[model samples]
Target: MVNISSCECMPWYVGVFRIRQRLTEEHWFDANCKYYTHVFDKTIISQVLGAIKYLSTIPKYEKCAKWLNENKQNLSQYFLEGFKSSKPLEVLIHGDCWTNNLLFKYNSKNTPVDLRLVDLQVSRLASPGSDINYFVYTSLTGDTRSKYFHDLLEAYYQSFSKVLILSRRKLPFTFKELEDDVERTKIVGLVIGLLAIPGIFFEGEDEIFDFGEMTEENMEEIFH
Candidate 1:
């Protein structure tokens, strides 16, 4: 379980970033353009579609495959809609919020005292939910995620609220509104998990394989 007080730093810092994003940029790049044309895009929708196509062929995840196929377009629309909402709750997201991106400094008693976030390569302006999705989904096991989902969200909200109060700015939305924003963009977690979880099992070394040297048989082995 995540202790609210210990983890308060995260949401408070996130709120600070959110305020910074609002003050500096009135608008972000178009979501569709970012999704499709950006060089480092690694388009989530496309990857999820590919994963769905591949996973559908396997028997165990047939239902997931079917849902992916049925909702693929809807999923894209949800992302686009999140971008289009009249009053978007936008923020500067850490982009890569997984455990590896955080460096912790511990106190004499070995309790965590401070944390520094590294890797700003993917930072962007987007819904706060996008950051939340990346952080929570990547860091927690599925069972823990399911069990403490609301508690985690509440912890974040409390910290965010405190930050807003300190900054002398009223929170733009209530906790209920935050919940709605999260629900609206829940597909981000789903698509990200589908595309990324497989890589977690890739237990190879850091050595790079030269695909240029591969023959047809090698290609088959690589794919399999």
Candidate 2:
């Protein structure tokens, strides 16, 4: 059974988690913008807020956040950084990429591989690395987090171009320019996703097993 609270949701991250699987294909063709029969669940959101706080306390996440804070003023600067770097080749990003639900039929022919992202729930306008980071973080876990973060980030920057340095990106005055946004964003996104742990998605019948018991403490964590 897939546990939602163990997954990602925050800054509307829960939307991706709450998305009903049956509609994934339809939404994919629509460029990933899909809403739901339900709105954000306060109970689920509570758990997420608490989780973000708890996960942020972990050293792996903290080290990443600390580095971000030391350089750029905050996380939002990433959007601008990406917009400036790309070769006018922007496409919708599968904003959430912890798992790739879409299946592909591979051909042995030496043709360019064109990926069709199956779930469009998290798809939104963003840079190349947006989907890339999600895949790498979830695909690689544990020590993989330690070893490949920098290398993966560097590759993404290189894929964009030589002059598109993250250093030129703008950020809040409270923070300075950071040397690396991709690396910092990668870990931060993953941790915050766990922090905003989403509610479970179920097919029907108000499955009791799907939802974890909601406590007032968890609620306070979310809206706080």
Candidate 3:
């Protein structure tokens, strides 16, 4: 993690960014936090993109062309070994995510103030969908759930992919490689398999999944 000094450009955002930079799920936090934190902080959406941008900038992906001159050691291929589906970006991801694991508390005025991501037991280098699919699965719909889900994820993907445009000339993979990532979900049951964990289906009133949403379109949009 970069020092707070690095974020001097934006002081108010310092605490949020510093915490995210220093904390990797690799080292366990104190047990005081019971939920497994997969992510932390209300990362500025732009800053999240900034972190991914750093990855794309570190090495040129075009080295794949020369075969011998490749900067990365066929790194994407190594990561793909475990997956039966295609990939997009060969990027690092939160790996584990779902609404239940994310902890958010609004301030006194009911404004969002803190975000503590929990459950990193499975964080890994995987498709961005690894994170996105989880949210799609776990996020609760209010009377207007689908509207938010589609809007938020598309906003995420658009911002996430912006950095790659600069890497266009050196991109190692083909259009098909990227498209395959989104297409893989078209196969039945995959997204659900990733999201339908036992923890999310807890029994009893304390475990109720209800969020009191109304509107058939909202429900339909979530599953659609």
Candidate 4:
């Protein structure tokens, strides 16, 4: 068996865009309309749609109820639409950016030296937020997220901007634009978090799962 020591791990989402730019410019693949589609199953989409609709009916989500009720019918499509973007800004992203797909190596002083990402099979060309949302929402705790969210975003923007400069391409959008896109497409993470947090974290393996577990109490306690 191979033994690997745990290390600090943070995703470099900019590398994904950099690599895709190189591949497309070099004519490795048709970058026009061709992109990785079908990141998740229709059944999963249906389930999350159902969950969102259920959330709307709860008293806790009353503020969101208006929007959810208005959009539940098309919630699945909206979730999928979050994966798309203009060709200039689009790139291959590790669609599944959750913890299991990542590993890191550390120096003797416990500083992270390298990050290794596995499970490239689900990678796709999409908006930058596709990977960002997945990694941030899934990996970070509530306190850590609140504390470092701004700094983390700034770091990503700097790295991505540097890559764009190296590629000799004009920055397609400003840092604020990226921030707005993340906020707009946040539903993707919201849906995934809804399913992942309650199902995977709270429910024990031997326990029977219940739909009711997707409650405000559970979400606030577990997610926050």
By lDDT, the candidates rank as 1, 4, 2, 3
Please, what are the lDDT tens digits per residue for candidate 4 over residues 69-149? 566555556666776777665666777777667666778897666677788766666777767777667767766666676
CA deviation > 4 Å runs, candidate 1: 1-9, 34-61, 72-88, 205-224
Residue pairs whose backbone atoms clash in candidate 3: 36-118, 36-119, 37-117, 37-118, 37-119, 38-118, 38-119
**What ranking emerges by TM-score with the best candidate at the front?**
1, 4, 3, 2
Model 2 misplaced regions, further than 4 Å: 1-45, 49-91, 102-116, 157-179, 183-192, 195-224
Cα-based TM-score, every candidate = 0.72, 0.38, 0.41, 0.66
| Best model per lDDT | 1
Candidate 2 lDDT, tens digit per residue, 55-89? Answer: 58887787654554454322233322442223233
Q: With candidate 1 superimposed using the best TM-score fit, by how many Å does residue 142's alpha carbon deviate from the native?
A: 1.0
Candidate 3 Cα errors over 4 Å, as ranges: 1-88, 142-145, 161-180, 186-199, 204-224
- RMSD versus native structure for model 1: 5.4
lDDT of 1 by residue, 1-224 (tens): 23333354566556566666655554455556642433212344455677887897888999888887777656655544543333447666776776667776777886766677789776767777767876777667777678677987887788777877888987877889878878877766775666456666567845334546756455444433
Question: Per-residue alpha-carbon lDDT of model 3 for 46-125, expressed as tens digits?
Answer: 22233334445657743433332231232222223322323334444444554555565566775555456577565544
Candidate 4 lDDT: 0.60
Q: Which is better, 2 or 3, measured by lDDT?
A: 2
lDDT, residue 94, model 3: 46
Backbone clash total for model 3 is: 7
